[model samples]
Target: MGTMVISGTVVLVVLGFGNHTWWLVAVAVLFLYMQYGRSGRVGRGASTSSPGGSGGGASGMTPGSYRAYRDRRDKQARWERRYRREHPMEARRQARERKS
Candidate 1:
């Protein structure tokens, strides 16, 4: 199933990386499998099982969704901060648009 596909993809990526001596691809796949696959499943399950899923189904906002939203917001904020440092005037224009 999903595991088979993941394994096959990992094998292909590793084989492709063999041309170079880069072990990072293997490490990256391992990390992605461990953190993303498990946590994503758990998050999806939790969100679907929560209350107020009246009609929104999987797209409904739950604790898991809020956590994801907050995480995205924080990441966006970090990027915006960096962008502002690089282009202060553009950032100011964006802020003005938001105000309008």
Candidate 2:
């Protein structure tokens, strides 16, 4: 599925270049970048483990690391909640300052 889409896009870009349509070539390059460049799945020097592999999940996060990440995020959330509850005025002031 993905291959077919990419192949079709490449064909279009090639055809555009053959016809000397500079704008089409530019648009094709931009489209390809928008489709693939911003996606986090394609990172340089990053290794992705296969299904049922020795380590890591589908998103390349290992169990221990995922747990630690979640714990840190939860702790931060709890601290923020407690801070907002205990220092509403300070929180509000900080928010206002950030907005400006």
Candidate 2 residues 1-100, lDDT tens each?
5566566667767777668675476576666666666543443444444334566443565333555478679999999999999999999999999999
Cα error of candidate 2 at position 84, Å = 3.2
Best model per TM-score:
2
Model 2: residues with Cα > 4 Å off, grouped in runs: 22-69, 78-82, 85-88, 91-100
Give lDDT per model, in order. Answer: 0.66, 0.66
Per-prediction TM-score to the true structure, in the order listed: 0.31, 0.37
**Runs off by more than 4 Å, candidate 1:** 1-64, 97-100
